[model samples]
Target: MKRSVLFAVLFSLSLHAFAIDTKLMVRAKAKDAKFVGSSIGGAHIIVRNTINGQILAEGITTGSTGNTGLIMKTPKDRFAQLADDKTAGFLAVVDISEPTFVRVEVISPISRKNAQVHASTELWLIPGKDILGDGVVLEIPGFVIDILTPNTHQYIPLESIKSTGLDVKANIVMMCGCPIEKGGIWDSEVMEVKAVVKKDGQVFGELTLANPSRNLFEGNVKIDGAGSYQVLVYAYNPTTGNTGVDIINCVVTE
Candidate 1:
């Protein structure tokens, strides 16, 4: 868990810093609950347009010299670290099409199993001159859960609301740094998965979600009237007392 080893990555960007070309010395958190300690072999790192979802550039972490010497020209002594360790340091180069915001997607192994059982996280990046400084810092979250209804990012349809109720679901998983179905990992059997309803940021009702799948839980809410409503999903594990929460906003109209 002590991924605090010092390293360097240098990008020769004088003015055209339109892409992520740098060395990464991973600086881990104080208590990273999801640290796997070893490189996530064969992980795919992608930099893309957040709005249009267009892929700008992509690279794969090979736990060694996949793109080290191929992309690195004479890197400075500060860029001495190699991409030999996935959980530690590496060289990453990303091309940005335009000066706009972007999203970095990391889909990596659920342990070293070819990353076939994979997990992903989307970290946002602002338009910058270069991908220097702290390098690309990405957090493989300890858990993953998001609103899975309406098949979008926290957006619910206005017409989908009926007088009876509205159903909202979420897919929750534990990032134990290993495969789930393989049994050597922490499971996603939530102790309590509840959807707390709030109107204009005021607390109102909370419903305990019912599990429809091993990794999915859902709840129903009947709205009297809605301008903007917030559905806060909270998932807790009694075994570890670890919790994960997410928020989704919906606007209902006639």
Candidate 2:
């Protein structure tokens, strides 16, 4: 009987010494916008052990963009919950014997590689403790700028280009896919959009894009006998220090 009791006690102690599964929730929030979710291509989440660089958990956030009123409109007090059960997040359960320092990385709007922004943070996680409810919110700053004109690797006749200047256009929106319009939530008036033009690796010129409609910025670039032209369209919100860029290459046949 004593031997059996001793063996049982040892087994219990061994189990206690083993690692505990801790729950961690990670979310990607677009700066000045909302959560990065399935509608705009969910954010890729990676949680790693900072000391040994071991990836503890890896997954993509899934769900909605979250409540806009709570995230954007409402005045937030201390410890206000901006996310709900449906809010997009990646829940990771990590097994750790003791407190471990971890690095959390998020690549937002994963579908749009051209406009994807990376954000990361580090914190110590205690065993058996779960960080849920709004979790670790990492803010991604930038706009999603997609160049609409001068399609990627497009070839245009030299005569056609000379007749009319190149029309540069882009679709600009917040990283969360929030529409940027005049006097809207994301005001376009406060942002600047431009297209940097280049020819054969030489600086050609730059054009200030004007917003003619919601989420659309357009400009005209005077092609100076284009030869292997490249256009990079970018959007910058000076007030928020947010910016994003998308590039396209086209050839003007001589």
lDDT of the candidates, in the order given = 0.52, 0.91
Model 2 lDDT-worst window of ten: 218-227
Q: Pick by lDDT: which candidate is best?
A: 2
Off by over 4 Å in 1: 1-141, 150-159, 176-185, 188-190
The alpha-carbon deviation from the true structure for residue 82 of candidate 2, after best TM-score superposition, in angstroms, is 0.8
Question: What lDDT is reached at residue 168 by model 2?
Answer: 93
Tens-digit per-residue lDDT, 1-254, candidate 1: 23332222223353355554432222221012332233434345666667898876666544321232422344447655323333332234444434555666565433433113333335544344454433554544444566776343344455667666778788765433322221223444436778988867887678998875566778888776656677888877676665667777776665
Q: Which stretches of candidate 2 lie over 4 Å from their true place?
A: 1-17
lDDT of 1 at 200: 71
What shift in Å separates residue 82 of candidate 1 from its native position after superposition? 22
